[model samples]
Target: MTVRVGLTGGIASGKSSVSSILAELGAVVIDADALAREVVAKGTPGLDAVVAEFGDDVLGPDGELDRPAMGALVFADPGARRRLEAIIHPLVHRRSAELEAEAAPDAVVVHDIPLLAEVGRAGSFDAVVVVDAPVEVQVDRMERERGWSRAEAEARIAAQASRADRLALATYVVDNTGTLDDLRRRVTEVHAELAARA
Candidate 1:
């Protein structure tokens, strides 16, 4: 049987790092963020829908989605963000299902979904792994890694489900407040447990 795992965390919470380690440990990783981009690529219907909803300003000169432009609009307005999600989520879900179907029967399928909690998809998976970090750590990491100002980072963080919410959905919680080595060890333990289940 395939063990379907939902892996999620807030921005700058080291979810990506945990996903990478899970992939290295032999899970078939399906990344939702990557699918989100693919669904809205320049020539796709997803992009067309976005353009229709948000106007042409959300597109760059080259005709692709201007992410920063879109981000600024949606993050400031909850309704706008919901409108965008309405267009993108279905496409990503269909694509994710297709990818999961293609995995081997006994594979440990890890779906790396940054918005799993916000999207309310925890119950769809056999297990949920949440990479958790404090809000202060997330703010600091965003500033150091993504060059975002304090307010910018906070805005992004505020847009997602809270740390407590994500934790409540987790079957396996990987605490990410420490060193890289610590994260790896914690993820390894989680991966081993999932692998045993598979």
Candidate 2:
């Protein structure tokens, strides 16, 4: 049987790094963020719904979704953000299911779902691993690595549930407050464990 693992964490908590390591270790990783982008690509129903709801201003001159513009609007307005999520989340779920179905029988499939906790899908996976870091550490990483302003970083953080909430749902937790090597070691350990279980 395929082992379905849900990997999640706060913004800049190194979840992506951990997920990448798992992928390199031969786990089939279905990245929700990548699917979110795919589902909203120019001609999809997701893009059609978004355009109808938010109008042309949310599109760039090339007629593609203006991510920065839509991001700014959604982060500032809860209702707009919900509307956008309503349109895209279902599409993402569909695509995720497809990916899961396509996994090899012995594959250890990791669904890197940022909002796994928020969406109440924790039980959908055989195990849920949360990559964790202190909020201040996340802020620093975002600012220094991503070149995001403090306010921008904080806004993204605020959009998600508290760290405590994520931790409560975690079947396993990998703290990411340390160095990259440290984080990698933790992921390597987890990857081996998942492979054994598979």
Candidate 3:
């Protein structure tokens, strides 16, 4: 039995850190963001599909997808965002399935999905682990680490599912407001539970 865990959290809330720890603990981690980029890389059909839907101007001089340029268009327009998802989501799913298939039986497989709640997909996993921090903690990290302006950080946070919503589906919640050692301890505890389940 493979224990499929979906790990998600607000932007800058430390999902990546937890995912890294889980990987180090022998979980087969499938990263959605990495696969999203891979699907849209210079030579893939995902990039070509984007060019077909949005036109060549979304590409940079070197012919790669100019992400920020395209982000500007999609983030500001709901229809455009959906169209882009229509192109990329299936490809991401297919690749993710392939990676999940490669994991051993009884291995704990974690899907690091930033938008699991926003996409209403928390129930698909055998368990969901939410890396939680207070909104202020999230905003502070976004500003201090990612250098996002206060408004930008707030906007990004607001765009996701509410904390209550995420927690409602969580099998494990790693509160990340404290020190690194504290967070690591919580992660290890959760990892042990997931491994036991497997």
lDDT values, one for every candidate: 0.94, 0.92, 0.93
Could you tell which candidate, 2 or 3, scores higher by TM-score? 3
TM-score order of candidates, top first: 3, 1, 2
- For residues 86-179, write the lDDT of model 1, one tens digit per residue: 9999999999999999999989999999999988889999999999999999999999998989999998898788999999999999999989
Q: Is candidate 1 or candidate 3 better by TM-score?
A: 3
lDDT, candidate 2, 49-161, per-residue tens: 99999998999888789999999899789899999999999999999999999999999999999988888999988989999999999999999999999998898898899
As for candidate 2, its clashing pairs are: none
Best by lDDT: 1
Residue 108 error, candidate 1, Å: 0.8
Q: After superposition, how far is residue 160 of candidate 2 from its true place, in Å?
A: 1.1
Off by over 4 Å in 2: none
TM-score of 2: 0.95
Question: What tens digits encode model 3's per-residue C-alpha lDDT throughout 13-60?
Answer: 999999999998899999999999999999999999999999999999
TM-score of each: 0.96, 0.95, 0.98
Q: Is candidate 2 or candidate 3 better by lDDT?
A: 3
lDDT agreement of model 1 with the native: 0.94
Off by over 4 Å in 1: none
Worst 10 residues of 2 by lDDT: 189-198
User: lDDT value for candidate 2?
Assistant: 0.92
